[model samples]
Target: MSRTVPYQPVLLRLLHSAIALLVFGSLITGFMVYDRYDKRFGTLNLPIIRDTQGIHGTIALAFLCLLPLFAIYCFHIGDRRLIQKESFKQLQEVGKPIWWISLQRFANSLLLVSATFAVITGRMMQEEWLPTGEFNHVWYIGHLIGWLLMFVSVAIHLLMSAKVGGLPLLLSIYNWKIRPEDMPKFWLRGFKLKPSTTFLFFFEAVVIGGIAIAFILPLIFTSPQ
Candidate 1:
């Protein structure tokens, strides 16, 4: 008899992968922009690169599009996994197995907050400001702070995930040997807009609307310069 590894739901894996890629891309582009332009905080001596500010802006735009959808899925289907109401109470088990689960939840919650800050602050940044050496903007300061917070949150997330389930939980996000009856197609039914899903539908609509407004408001209000 072979041991079967526990598998994550395909929908969860898909969402996680998409979010991970976007987050990683944004982080890379953000660093490149920082190194290429801003060094007021710290300096990394590297070869000069041109046009990364534009690349960073492009990735940030994609992040704004995907993040709201990811947040919807997270709050709707994955909130319990990331953070339960009882998580704080698990602090009593600080030296025991339960503590690690709570830690992971807390880390995930922190990561979400950090990512939200990154997205919002990234949007607030005017594209023409950074490469032009205009780091005095409040939004740029907030963006830098968001970047640091995200870096710390991601480190905590990785360490907690490694401690909790070792490599199994980590690999579960990419596992493909799901049971025959557990096909991705079977998962589609859960997405149907029934009474149970009505609230999620409403939540997703609100998120999408908010993102659209955030993107459109500046264009509408900012007069031609």
Candidate 2:
């Protein structure tokens, strides 16, 4: 039989699946929530809240509920590099600057804080629920800023993930039951593969650039409600 490799953590698989769904849902609703504020983001062609409130609030609330669990998982995995700045000290000897770690921490902090505020504000804005003040006001201001922060944070997270053996670590979550044949290849430091040349390097840039561009375009020249 052929061989295979699993790169993510077993626990991460469960958490990532949960996180992915909730996050995607959260993003959808976020689009709706933001639609209420500034319906334009260049040529990205996004929809406003008026376009869809279907699950925006629900996912926002769910995300609020799910975050604590995720926090626990992050701690359980010994991956506190984001919150625990001291953990990154080991990388400093290789000419890697300390500032990078600080920046990573800041990015992580921004994502959590912004997401937290957005969730709180979102709950407050819900009409069918609590006795929150009208969401039609300046709360949009906070939400807009928070969303922007999240976008920036995710960008940094993806970049940093790659640098820190994030691919195998993330993939490891799937528990793919790595096979024996893949061992030699991995141990070879990819040297046995003809020291290949391929488009793999450009893959991430394309994906990240694509999403960033897509999000920004709708804000620019599109009334795509």
Candidate 3:
């Protein structure tokens, strides 16, 4: 008996891989910045990197830039992987395979929400605040909590995916073999924005607009002051 490996779309793999790398970089550099500045929880004995904050911000900005495209793809094309209208009802079927699948979908949705939370809060943060010993800002606290939630969400996401799809499913995202239909050249041909996803696309647009405003407002207020 052989385990079956499911095929993943090449665009999904590319977007997922890029986002994963950016998230991982942001997490490590975020910790380094935290350790360098505010260590109320406990400090690491690592050598200080003066530019960790800047590096973290750069990675975060990259994540922000990529998020809208990823969100659009996920909501429109990969919507099945996210929580559905029947998800909650399916949860009542505990111990059934559908229960696990529903749980995985919920976890997948949570990852998106938490990632957005972390990114928005991060965009609202000021680089100088932590270095200047201002550790209690509401945005900073929210950012810290957001990242913590995102870390937990990521773990839950992996566990749920493993539970639902097993190792083969886990490896599917990294599968490099692309079906002829999923080729980049044919993507536009198959891509149809369904009316059902209109609301989601609008919500994503609002979030992206909010992020842009968050990124721009500080500069506007602080300029030449």
Task: Give the 10-residue window scoring lowest on summed lDDT in candidate 1.
Answer: 189-198
Ranking by lDDT: 3, 1, 2
Candidate 2 overall lDDT versus native? 0.50
Off by over 4 Å in 1: 1-4, 181-184, 188-225
Q: Which candidate number maximizes TM-score? A: 3
TM-score of 3: 0.88
What tens-digit string does per-residue lDDT give for candidate 3 at 39-67? 99888856998788988999999998898
TM-score preference between candidates 2 and 3, better one:
3
| Candidate 3 Cα deviation (angstroms), residue 131 | 1.1
Q: Give the least accurate 10-residue stretch of model 2, judged by summed lDDT.
A: 188-197
Q: For each of the candidates, give the backbone clash count.
A: 0, 24, 0
Off by over 4 Å in 2: 1-8, 40-43, 46-51, 76-79, 85-106, 126-136, 174-225
What TM-score does each of the candidates earn? 0.82, 0.56, 0.88
Model 1 lDDT per residue over 1-225, tens place: 112355677777877888888778888778878877788778786576677777777877877787776766666656555666577789778778888888988898777777766776677677778667788887789889989998899889989987877877788888866676567676643443332344444544554555666577567646312
Task: Kindly report which residue pairs in candidate 3 clash with one another.
Answer: none
Query: How many clashes would you count in candidate 3?
Result: 0
| Global local distance difference test of model 1 | 0.72
Candidate 3: C-alpha lDDT: 0.80
Worst 10-residue stretch by lDDT in candidate 3? 187-196
